[model samples]
Target: MIAIRLRSSCGAALVGVLALATSGCGLSAELDRETNPERKPTPSETRAVLPPVSATPSPSVSVQPVSGCPSSGLRFEVGRVDGAMGLRAMTLSMTNCGEQPYELNGYPSVSVLDEAGAPIPGVRTAEGTDEVPVAPPGSAPEPFTLKPGETARAGLLWRMAAEDGTYLRVAPDKKRDFVNVRPEEPLDIGPENILGTTPWAPAS
Candidate 1:
């Protein structure tokens, strides 16, 4: 009876030990699965997007008219300005280096134009009502006359409404031929040719 009881006790102890070992293996596997889970991308994966670049436009150049009287004859040159008001108020001048007297008629005409070459506002002369006539070299000088070896200067104050390109035309009177005047300076009446060849001053 004693031998039978001891064998029974040993059998119970072996069953308990196997049960404990099986439970410990199951807990270790569960812990490994909980600690290392499968990975997946989140919804905020937008770091690869890029922004676009923009380009700038080139600037346009403004042109004015100019005419000069050299000793031999008339020489013509064109001037180009970049600012806004250079087209509005201006001073037109001419140098007379000939032995005879020279006469200039009609005020310089101002015209404001759009990109299509159509006149933006209207074309007009910017001068006062005073008549400027020609006389002898030493006599009183005015806008229309330049004594021999004398320099004649005139002022033009123009009011304009322009968006882009505006220009001035310094033309001689249709009746008066600049070639007939002494030292025969070239006559310029085109757009974009009026500023430098002829010395100028700002309207005061």
Candidate 2:
């Protein structure tokens, strides 16, 4: 079974429930019944025919940082919510692994998924918030620049219709898409301290 991590938000849960309606398992059964309801058993039905299987291996994923961020070694952690807020948020922890100081300007993107590995529509970034800044309150907040071997924390929030698949994604900015962070990397989201928990995992 596919289990998605969720918060107490009623809105996210409502979206999850609606997603269940379009799932494949039930739809497949319904299609079978509709197509062959009046057919009688044939000799072929009694014969066991094992289909040929291929030996090719499935693709494997490795946890890697987006290209330029490797030197910064930024890591993310997510928390559970109490209910669906028109907005969803998570905290990001960034560490500077390289000798040079790093400058962090924007927040990452977040995506919610369903059991079938499809992205839940209606989820987006909240209005008026470009990206949560790392600058402190009333700090005149010069651009956030972490020194060598320094660590900083920031919050990344998004506006989503609902929370589904126990999975969430934190991605880099659009111009930085070339950073190439692997989507399957384990995030420090609360409750399992596990990695590779993407919604795209094979169905149970």
Candidate 3:
């Protein structure tokens, strides 16, 4: 025969509660059910399965660096804007003659040329004004693209001094060779700087 004994205080109270459970208390049955709980579903319990994923290859793209335009295929054009207060406004335009696209930007190097094709001294470079807007206007330079037959522009500002010079020599920045240009319709750049240019931009 099995014999059970309870001591004083909490143990005795617990035994009294179990005696109530024998009289049909649900609390004891609920506790017993929780102690030996049913098993829950897990990932491996499901019969459905998904196959492993296969990676697909993506297409590749190659990028090319921009390059300066060749001087040989470029034709430069000068346009007259206005003349007031002794300052002349003009646009310097360059057209691409070749079949390929070329990249250029910033101010084109410029200098006054003498009768014998020599550069005149003492002519300094400065920023050109909007009276004759340059391509990619503003102080900074921007990358400009030119396709075949397309033109780019810069602003030209200078005073016409009979004693100064005859022709103008201009070239892409960092380029050794240059193009000789002469203003047909001269603007009376009276008291302004003797020479100036703006950063290059594509002509609209």
Supply candidate 3's per-residue lDDT for 31.
Answer: 68
Instruction: Write candidate 1's Cα lDDT for 1-204 as tens digits.
Output: 212332344456567878998999999878767766654433675587565421111134233222344444322222222112222223345455566765564443334343333443434332442221110011122344556655554443322223343333333333432321111121122333222222222122
Minimum summed lDDT over a 10-residue window in model 2 is located at: 194-203
Cα lDDT, model 2, residue 20: 81
Regions of model 2 farther than 4 Å from truth: 1-72, 80-89, 114-118, 127-142, 157-162, 177-204
Error of 3 at 84 (Å): 0.5
TM-score of each: 0.32, 0.38, 0.53
Q: Any residue pairs clashing in model 3, and if so which?
A: 86-189, 86-190, 88-189
Q: Which candidate number maximizes lDDT? A: 3
Give the Cα lDDT of each candidate: 0.36, 0.40, 0.56
Model 3 Cα lDDT, one tens digit per residue, 1-204: 000110122245566767776767677667657775773433456577776432221122111112354547777766644443333446677788778787896788777655455555555566543333222234567897888989887766654444434455777664646766665533333222356676788777
Candidate 2's C-alpha lDDT?
0.40
Question: For model 1, how many clashes?
Answer: 10
- Indicate the TM-score of model 1: 0.32
